[model samples]
Target: MMQRCFSLLFGMLAWSAAIALEAPAESHPGARAFAAELARDPLAIEQGLSEAAILATLDQARYQQTIIDAISRPAESKAWKDYRPIFLTDKRINDGVAFYRAHADLLQRLEKEFGVPASIIVTIIGVETSYGRITGKYRVLDALTTLAFYYPARAPFFQGELKQLFLLHGTRFPYATTELMGSYAGAMGWGQFMPSSIAKFARDEDSDGKIDLWNSISDICASVANYFTAHGWQTGGPVAVRANVDKNARVITPGSLEPVYPLTQLEEWGYHLGSNPGGAKPDGQTPVTLLQLEGAEGTEFWIVFQNFYVISRYNRSPLYSMAVLQLSEAITRELSKPAQ
Candidate 1:
């Protein structure tokens, strides 16, 4: 629903407003007074969200230097030559194996309950936070507040997320004072969910009253599965498949999310699919996109399926989606190996 809303709103009028929310003064009488005013005029509460005072507060919030630093150092800067070595290290792979083993039961449960593969779930966690070893250190509130109020490109989306976070604070999705730290983009937990995702899909796997994203492995695991399930994950379907395409065939560039043509069309266009079902194309015949990722040997290519598109919903970058898929395959292969 939010996705549709975003798509519709993207083409509409662009509001010119500074995007950051001012950090609430600690127990400031002004904040209390504002809160009381909002409580009294429910309409004001709705309108106050975008009121001049609120926008002023948001604009007045200082830029967090740490957030600026973290967002700048995306893993892709080192090129695939260096980046592949970082994520595909024997240490990281072995650690992933251990993580899978330790959470075998929960992983199995998520697969059974959510119909999303455990390998995919675990791979997402691994790729995002090294299997929960490092889930960022910035305070989520500051991050969301900063991005929502200051980042003009995606301010409305982040502002909605900030609203969701505050709402979560008062609901079943309670948080501890210390554990509410996450990415500078305000994504939380092992799967790095934005606040809206957390509010809508986060589940309490341990049946605890709280749906804590930090430090609670069960909740985090469950939340990951829940997100996949909510976002149209197809159980046991291919996430992606290796494909061979002629140079004359259709070329897929980065950031292409639209499914324009049929599989039969792709075949006529000189693209050869590796997996055919009963000498016929797969059901739905959903259009496939060729994604090229730089690897150690050379350019690696794959035909991404609808499920792969679903993965893109989590992180829009083609590189990120490809990395997550490769990580999943790698972990699954390592798990299938003979035990020592």
Candidate 2:
């Protein structure tokens, strides 16, 4: 059965590669405007493809309403209560445990080397693509090109990503832009790294001289750890803790995820530690932030520490960080139980 599955996978990959190579090299009329723009870059020329060819490939990408709609209503926009169940599911938690055990050695080594917890790394992969089961169905070229030229709000950012994608295609990864698949926003692989993130932090963990996040578990896990370490993740630190706040007291929550207040200041403002399993309370001088999530049950409060803020750096979403933390906790708890 495993042999048959492997053969089937190989066949699909070969088919995809063939399709990518057959893509037209001529520029589409719509893409001519961007062709000169992309050609101005020396790096684009270094890719060995003419500016027209690059833009022609991009021209095949159409403006997708699904992309616009997906970006407009991200999971982070939902309240904690609503968002929590989406990622912290029974299936995700169970599959996370299985994945952790399967990659125990790699996870342990990554933690020792990068100072990121194994559970946290596992949770990230689980949330991003359910351990590689659902990386995405959209072509990365289509996603980035559509967003770069059509999405008015984040066009500049997507345009930059589009450039980086071309650069990545020229260098580290040798594949057609249309051949690779990823999220609507061009985040790829199990870790859902943007093109810039892949260029900056992705690693070839197995030392095979190729970084394949789609199929290489070692690269995927290590790349995630590298990203956390780069973003200043503190080892052995609390991610967040439930906090009790006075109902009548006016609490000041920072508009951003960055930690702005010290623990002493938060305590003085009527925030007290509520439930912490790790049992390590930070010192008075430790930086913290109050995260309040509105739910069906009214409101929930959490005291987010440095690690929580670091997690937010990945996606800039408090809900996302919370999901990763809670999912990690759930996976750890499940792993501790005896086999059924």
Give one digit per residue, the lDDT tens place, for model 1 in 1-340: 9999997787453432122223343223333443343344554465344345443443333446566566667776655655766666677677778889999998998899999888888888888888888887777767866665456667778767765665555446657423478888888888898888987888888987888777788898888888888888878766666667788876656468444556566677666677652134565477676666677788766667777888888887666776777777788889999998
Give candidate 1 regions above 4 Å deviation. 1-62, 76-82, 176-179, 251-255, 275-284
lDDT of 2 at 172: 52
- Prediction-by-prediction clash tally: 8, 0
lDDT against the true structure, each candidate: 0.70, 0.85
Stretches of candidate 2 above 4 Å error? Answer: 1-33, 277-279
Model 2 lDDT, full chain set: 0.85
What does candidate 2's lDDT look like per residue over 1-340, in tens digits?
9999999999999998766543332323435656677777887776566776776676576556677789888888787888888997899999999999998998999999999999999999998999898998888887887777667799889888887887887435766787989999999999999999999999989988878998889999999999999998988988898888877656685898777899888888888888763866788888888999986588988888889999998888999998999899999999899999
Give the clashing residue pairs of candidate 1, or none. 19-149, 19-150, 20-58, 20-149, 20-150, 21-58, 22-57, 22-58
